[model samples]
Target chain A: MSGVTGQGPRTDLLAAVEQVRALAAKHAEETDEAARFPVAVLDELRTTGLLGLLVPAEYGGLGGGLDELLDITMELGRADMSVAMIFSMHCQQVAGVVHHAGPRLAGELLPLVAAGRMYLASVTTEAGKGGHLLTATAGLTAEDDGLDIDRFAPIVTGGEYADGFLITMRSPEARSAGDVSLVYAHRDQLTITPSGDWNPLGMRASHSTALRLTGRIPEHQVVGEHGQFRTVVLNTFGPLAHLGWAASWLGTASGALSRVLRLLRSPDGRKGANLDSELLMTRLSRSRQRLETVHALMRHTAEVVTRVRAEGDDLSRPRYQMLINSLKITASEECHRAVEDLIDAVGLRHGYLKGSPTGLERALRDLRSAALNYSNDRLHLADGKLALLDAEVRFA
Target chain B: MDARFTELLTPYLPYLGDRELTADTPLREYGLDSMQAIELMLSVEDTYGVELPDEQLTEETFSTAGKLWDALSGQLGGQGSDTAPAADAV
Candidate 1:
């Protein structure tokens, strides 16, 4: 379900996006399999230099800022949300390890990323039969080169293909009261047992299976301070990734709207053409308004995150926190909404009659993957409290 | 800066954007959001190995270039003090 990317000549970034679309379009079907990974697509990413998305220019990366990654991610999401998710996970890895682990560690790790010699997946979330922890809640031991992770993390994309898993560890190191540590484990040491299947409604190709992190973490691979890992997660990657993914969601939903509109304007080749012609314009108008609202929210959040990164104190401001929560909730909900409307606009005839259009089923699968893991009710309540609070509303 | 802080400021300046900040200007006037403020504090704490209380974030104490130097001088004054870095305000 890929669409044409950029024709704009202003930045090489547009070209980069076109490349992602080409790769995702090529693997749309194969990656849609519940158990299969887009290894080929990732190989293409390695060559495309998108893996070093967060790496600094001095380290031979594209050196694009946070916004660049967001734009590119949107294009990827449009092609296939599963691939976009993988890109997001990998970019988060790049931001965490390269930015915090000191110059020496970054010097060593940056080269591997720039060359596409290795791929990294996030093994932070875990799976439990009764209940699952939101993040890694286990511990690891200091080994010769890495931390020996004991439990497996669920929701890992690129697990089967990555050279390492950016696993979070827990310990009572007196350096900080919190019990979280950050470490990387080389791929060779662990086993990649499938959790179950990624038969999710959207992002079906995500392959976000559980990863058994029963392995060793060589000293060389242990990047970032285990002591201050939480700080890095909350303060650094938290807002940045939040805005980036939201922007991507906006772009994908926009693309879905565009695709549906294109179909509507086309000649009535189908016998049930009256179904689309009647209500298509009305729904299209609604989608446009929704998309615009998402766009405005993104603009607000991006500015706030930029200020929060450069300035500080703004995070506590009622405006910024509310915008942050609102962005997450709105983009996620609307993206899924756009997909539902788009599919219906295409009508049951497309699925039940016309087969499919450009992996439309895959698009639906990818969209729902993003829709989960969201609790708008809690978000809105917290946002309301923050808005009404007397004191500044900051976690710190 | 004691010759060391210069290195830190050099790398951090780009993060500050185009607004040319001076020691006298109120940091709030520019775009000193709390995340950046906290990030700056963390960087300072990591580099100096001195933890400051969270209250110092208010009161607009260290954010000003002038206040920052004053705070540093007070914290690092004379003989090495062992108490936690004093927090002024939020």
Candidate 2:
């Protein structure tokens, strides 16, 4: 069930990512204002060959691994977080398919991804489930040609616009919520209902609306072995999503600091009567330092994930889980602080604006999602268990 | 360890490739690092329904396929014989 990776070279893959980032930057403001999904950015990603970043090359993809995907994701995050996040969700879904799904399922979906025709969204997280990702409130029943999927996934990140979903649901034969399966459901096969409006303070363009879905999942589309979604989530989707979100926050920090850097270099900043150039420079350096820390954490975690995939090793280990959780907590908090420092350096006139000509206010709001999206509280509790049990765990 | 258990684990060691994986082959030769070693350990627990003690997670227990099999055999209350040949190993 294991396969090789890195069929594409890094430089070529990053070139495609840079193009997507340009498009994302162009549409970022409007996407945030309208709180709408970035349709144009998605189209640009597909055209640039970045949408297939995680699919293996044999299936017509770039054949890039998790490390390669992280490079693209972080760069995208730096340009437009909404686009990065939307793409991150797609990447997580791709990770699930590539690493865990049966060959027939991968054969069916990887081609569409390679051709830039489809995006896979993770349809997990129910209303009452809270942060319990493994438990499924909805259930799947076996039908004639496939299984009937009936569930109301409350927060599907790219659900409104995604072509398909990597959905979590309980099997008909399962005894409890612990016995769950992840199934693939195309948008055409599902009746989707928009249950909630997306109007978040930050990452407003993610279009993470609540969705009610009814569909049929064919036998081949049932990703991973039965009751193995926990393994899939712990080893594949969890790390990708956490690191991707960290990259987005780091990008937000980078974008905010870039604006401040521009301000520092302008005539008003350099030779103006009321400016303290040295103090501003100090703050700028501090902000950059924090961003660098976040980047280092993201890079190290990405390398481990890529190595595990390359070796075809099991991902569900106590140590790996500890790393993913800690990355999310530290990166989120540090990014928020970095963006705040940038705002302080820029001051009121430039910092208070919602959109560009210096977008500190918007950056702060967008970066705020890092701590709230997965709630560092939950991650801390998870890490607490590892801290007690594992005395000599290393981050790298 | 049950010979069937060693057969189940052989595939997890990516370096085996098309080569025959015998119990005597050193686990380290198959590129099993500490992380992969832990991964194999967890899978063994899951597959065989036996919880390996923390003390048994050392490099000595995982030096070779035969050593791992012997550890699991002890943990499983002697389900598998340790002194069998390659053919009888399974």
Candidate 3:
């Protein structure tokens, strides 16, 4: 198939990331301190062509895959976790649009994303689902103009700033919550009632707030085929989001550690004649090893998901999903440990304040969101359930 | 139905229950959703080692066992001349 409307996968990823780092560094402090949207960072991302990095080149994008996205997100995460997260959410939405939607729909939306004129965000959470993403408490009704969707999403990441939002709802002909449908709507088509604030412990710049949305959008905005929401979510959106989340964690932790490494190499740290340079170096090396492991796992999982898409049915298996979920848990925990060790290498006494030499406090706070984003406790339960299934255990 | 087609498709049609599928039986009536349809199609392609053209993947191809058989046979160059448009569709 022809790639989306752009040049082939971007060859200048390094150059683009260098520009993004500058923007991220400029906005990281105030954006996090005020819990504001990283508008400047996003604008720079769009201007630098990094916004369409994951979009197919045929659609005027870079045509890069998960690996390229990971590289960009990790660099962004190193600079600013919030900006990395917002970009990841945008990419996940783009994947749903290009991969699952029919050709005509893809033609309409992908170009806009590819051109950096649009950003997609998903609204899948509901008030009564109790953290279950697969189920929806809302319903869609067929109207004369199109479909009328009125639902309350307790939390929509990037909702306020999104150009388009993909929604999950029970199908119009459904008898139960299991029959779900997904649709995309231009932000102007919906009335989004802000239900809550977004101030949080970490990743404060993501703009994840609760919203009540009521809208009527044209039929063409519906994503995938009707009644295929479960399959599409499992096949496309779920995998992208999971991998993107892991990459974000890896990136942010690495960025914070880089600061600590700088501190270790400074005159203050090395000037002490009796300082245990060997021990500090070893600690930093071990932390780097942990980040490397996280990177490898994320890379391997993305490759597996890509292969499954081409080969079919592999990603849908319960065992494969279990393994992917474990990667999220492992990456989150390992990333936290890496940041902590880097902080120790920087020494706790000097500049131990919030905005310290290494900014370890902020990194730790941001890393905390990884585990709580989907909750490791819930993921472990899912793995336990899969343990009893009769299935082939395979890997890439 | 071709014997190979029957053998490959039967394993995926547990939803058809006790009703034996003939070449005339519409596959969709047995509650085979898109995913299952794709699964059966892929299984046929894998078994016969013939890649079905993307344009041939539609509600029409798998509407009935006969149509699917025709599509597969045509691609495989088997020349099975039972080409009645099986119309109890998906």
Candidate 4:
């Protein structure tokens, strides 16, 4: 698909992203300090027509794909990780609707997104299920003409600001937790009450707070077939989420590295003993290598996803599952490690100070959340089980 | 009904200890999760030398021992044989 105005999608999207980046960069410090959402950045995204990024061109969107998603997210991550994460998550839900929504629902929602009038939020996390996206403790109740949903999400990132939500819940006739469905509801269709405050060590601008949601949705609003949300999770949501987050973390690490490089090239750095120390140079080099490794792996996984989608192949295959899960695990860990290495290379004053000109302090705190975002330990456990069945590792 | 099938599946279903592995037993009740189901599918394929097609990969197919056995039998029978290869022979 071409750009919104017939220009190249990549170029047009990146140009708009550059504008958002400047705004996010400008407000990132205050956003983090105040523990608030970056309203200005989001406004820029809407005005630039980037909110409709993943919707198809026929629906008045740019019709961009996974590759474009990675580029936009990486750029945003460089400016502010919270902005990057919010945008990435929005795209994840858009992809879900675009790929799995029934024709009528698609026709209804995609144009609003394409017109940059909507921002979608994810509602997968339940109170007790920590990072488990495939199952739900809340079950939909059958009503006269639709299903009644009363779910308490433990953490809904950007929930208050979202124009709509894609929620996961047990089907009305579900016999087990795995019998799940993905449902969509506009903000006006539901009563969303904030239940708790969100004050975190990092990524504070995301406003991931507990929320109580009550609503009624028609059966037609279900994204896929009843009790078949597993297919949607494994196919679209899983891969795109992992890739988008990995790219965001990669951009965060690279942003810190850029700060470090700037310091090294300054006249004061040249006059001081810092530039001459091989140890410092070596540490920076190691960080660079790690970041580069993450970038390469993330790009490769995105390409694989694009290829699989293009070929009409199933992405839930064990090999692809392993690949996607492994990317999240590796990128989260490596990006954090790269940031830590840079912190040590730059020394205590610049790296440890809260308001240091280097800005590594904020980057460090933001990148720290990467490992705990979805919890790498949980993913490793899942991958460990999958590794037993998928013994052969084929690389093409 | 096959001893090899029982042997291959038993390890993953420790929750089903000492119970007779019947055709109608609900696999999920015996702690068969999505990942475990996939692992079980792979083992069945490796042991029986038959690939379960993508169309057959569904929650219903792995909902019970009977359904899973039927899927495996279908694949094995499609290879022009009613009898599975001997457990001890392979």
Candidate 5:
């Protein structure tokens, strides 16, 4: 909430990485280019226990927080955003589902996620919902036992991979679209048909396709309380998204920077007057500052989540909403700048190549869609400013 | 003054104490997982009131008690009165 402090979640950053790197090497470009999923790599990640990186150890997970999540996500993103996006939602589902569902259900689900027995995903996108449920016709009516739901959530990450879907629907209890409810739809219960190919310019393998929900969501499947979904899933999950996605931008930026430095100092690459030189440093310096602050925002956001975990009732709602929104905005802007700067500095040598620099291009496209997620609207940007000025935005 | 951290350093394989650490005494190599490192830094920062930069995670910075004392002293800027550090005017 307000004044986020603490070291957030702890994780064995290197220990978690040993296997990811191995599978990542063979995570071929052909699969990504063809808009095919990295099935083997995904399977490998699940087995590696990294699929549950966000789940706390108490819930049979590694108990990692934002920092470790970023470290792993960045490295994977540099290698493949397709993997990063897939993993991002996985962690996102862990963070949100666990947070909203409370410890008991979380304890049950997190262990399953950590053990890689079952993966989790967010069913929040919609062709009608502006990819963010901003404007949507999806509604949830009260069922005999639980909340029965029907919605078109487009662009779901881990959609094709996860065994369960955390879909968002407007509850009759809440009285409005913003008053959302989270229902955990098991893959067995709903129809998750892919709408089309995930043939984006970048992040070709994210494969965030459309899922058409067409059946009963039992009471046990409801992740959060009737009206708690919007603030929790939409507003709160923003920071988690920022932490995971921002790391992707950071990885690409750092990777590109390292590549330039290595080649520029070498005998063959030294003569360039292009981006491998003095003027690039100025842009890089500013970009670095922006990135560093974004990192701080990410840390701050995680601190809030951790605090909320420890002192559940003591959490501040409005502050959490604002900074969470801020982090999302900062993530979109800074990541865009990071990728743009990298392309400017490197001039797309391996990037635009027919078969080379697959990872870099994937990052570029996946990041382009960043501003589209979770209310990255100009109206919200204006609302974020007004939110700060008003100093009190009520949580539904 | 906290000898616990100093003692913790000894069991971490071994170290060749030059300006930086060697394979035997490599501080960077001493299983300083990012998670543990953050906790370690926080403990040190709260106990000693010095913020460690990501840049300062070099082998040289954590070579030995003596070199660590120098870096810590520089960062402390004389706020800490742990005077074993007082003799080293670094």
Candidate 6:
């Protein structure tokens, strides 16, 4: 509860985020054009100790929660969505460890993470599973004192660069596909072979390439109880992942709108005849309206998650699940729409140019991935099913 | 077993076509996922007009038709006691 809304002064964390934002802005274009990871920005985050932003203070981290995550990711999204996304995904893994790991694992791992010595990546998506996170095709092989797993994930964001991975596999004593376990393995314990290219429409710097991984995971490293990875998914990964992604997308839209506003106020824009056009003003206003709504929803959802965690409420309950799902769906769709409207308002000559002062072109391309990253269509189906169960529809 | 309970669960268990649902039948085998389990819980609550306590909302309670019915009947008080095993049988 203490760090839920970032209660105390977090000037140090915010200041470090500002520094990361500057670094992201500097290398964003080059990173995108080269379709590579934002090395300089991530290096800056490591050196600044911002990598441990979510780790508990007792473990040497800032002990920030979802609120702080939203603030940092939003700022990063404004500068470079890829950087924001990478950071967001990393935080998701850290949250899993924080919330679900046993005492021994927590004692051993959190300190390393808090010390900014480890960067975690997620390996939930499998070769033929699409984006499914609940079930696993790969089963863990029981070793004398641990588990061995060979997993082939079609997309592992920043896989090669991560110091460790949170991998999901079928439980050793599995009854069905849904019986899954989340295992943590350091890079040294795994033979990770990068496969496929990472060239994408946008978010190019995310470097989300396919990876073939085979690793040995000690028993203590298996998160939560055996076959309770679903609990971890529902409680931590699902909510935080959606919240972080939505925040980044919201930031992208907001950054675009700000740039457009700056352009409209410039001398060139003041001299233009369209500046007086009511249509342009209306479009800008509409974009702002959408972005504002998304902003409000993102903050509200983050607060709910923080409160639920503090109060020991079931996050998997129908109402909470629906709220979290709606946040992702609405933020992705609305933020994309806002970016589109801003682009329309800026017009082709400036908006269409890659090097335009408005910077709307890059923002447009980046925001396009917001909907497709996890595929809004899949979420809609899941939410539709959840809706059948959430009979009351309470909003309090 | 209530006919309405089976009727309500049939749609969610597409894998259980042309098969009668027995009390001991494992719901997961017939494709009753976590979401469907919740839907089933709501449908059972609606049909029985009984509000299941938060403590009764658990994976074990919904693991099978019999267990689910046992929990529902417990909420319903004396009725269906013949069908449900003793509350502390496990």
Best-fitting candidate, scored by TM-score: 6
Superposition error at B3 for model 1 (Å): 41
Which whole-number lDDT from 0 to 100 does residue A246 have in model 1? 76
Ranking by DockQ: 6, 4, 3, 2, 1, 5
- Candidate 2 chain B — worst ten consecutive residues by lDDT sum? B81-90
The global C-alpha lDDT for each of the candidates, from Candidate 1 onward, is: 0.61, 0.76, 0.76, 0.83, 0.61, 0.82
TM-score comparison, 4 vs 6, better candidate: 6
| Deviation of model 1 at A375, angstroms | 4.5
Higher-ranked by lDDT: 1 or 2: 2
Give one digit per residue, the lDDT tens place, for model 4 in A118-230. Answer: 98999999978767877789999989999998999988889989999999999888766877899999998899999877889999899889888999988899999887787
Error of 5 at B85 (Å): 67
Best of the candidates, DockQ: 6
Give the 10-residue window scoring lowest on summed lDDT in candidate 1 chain A.
A1-10
TM-score of each: 0.72, 0.80, 0.78, 0.88, 0.69, 0.88
Model 1 ranges off by over 4 Å: A1-10, A33-35, A128-135, A143-146, A172-178, A189-195, A218-223, A269-278, A312-319, A344-346, A351-354, A358-361, A374-396, B1-90
Runs off by more than 4 Å, candidate 5? A1-13, A102-104, A131-136, A141-147, A172-174, A234-236, A271-277, A283-287, A304-319, A348-362, A385-396, B1-90
DockQ-based class of model 4: incorrect
How does model 2 do on interface RMSD, in angstroms?
A: 12.9
* Fnat of candidate 5: 0.00
Instruction: Choose the strongest candidate by lDDT.
Output: 4
User: How do the residues A263-321 of candidate 3 rate in per-residue lDDT, one tens digit apiece?
Assistant: 66688756742256787778788899999898778877877787777786446565567
Interface RMSD of each: 12.5, 12.9, 10.2, 5.1, 21.6, 4.3
Residue A115 error, candidate 3, Å:
1.4
* Residue B35 displacement (Å), model 1: 20
Model 4 clash pairs are none
lDDT of 5 by residue, B18-82 (tens): 33332233343333422343345556656565565533433344433555555555575553425
After TM-score superposition, the amount by which residue A187's alpha carbon in candidate 4 deviates from its true location, in angstroms, is 0.5
**Two-chain complex of model 2, DockQ on C-alpha atoms against the true structure:** 0.04
Tell me which residue pairs clash in candidate 2.
B1-B69
Could you give me the TM-score of model 3 versus the true structure? 0.78
Candidate 6 lDDT, tens digit per residue, A118-172?
8899998887777777889999999997899899999888998999999999989
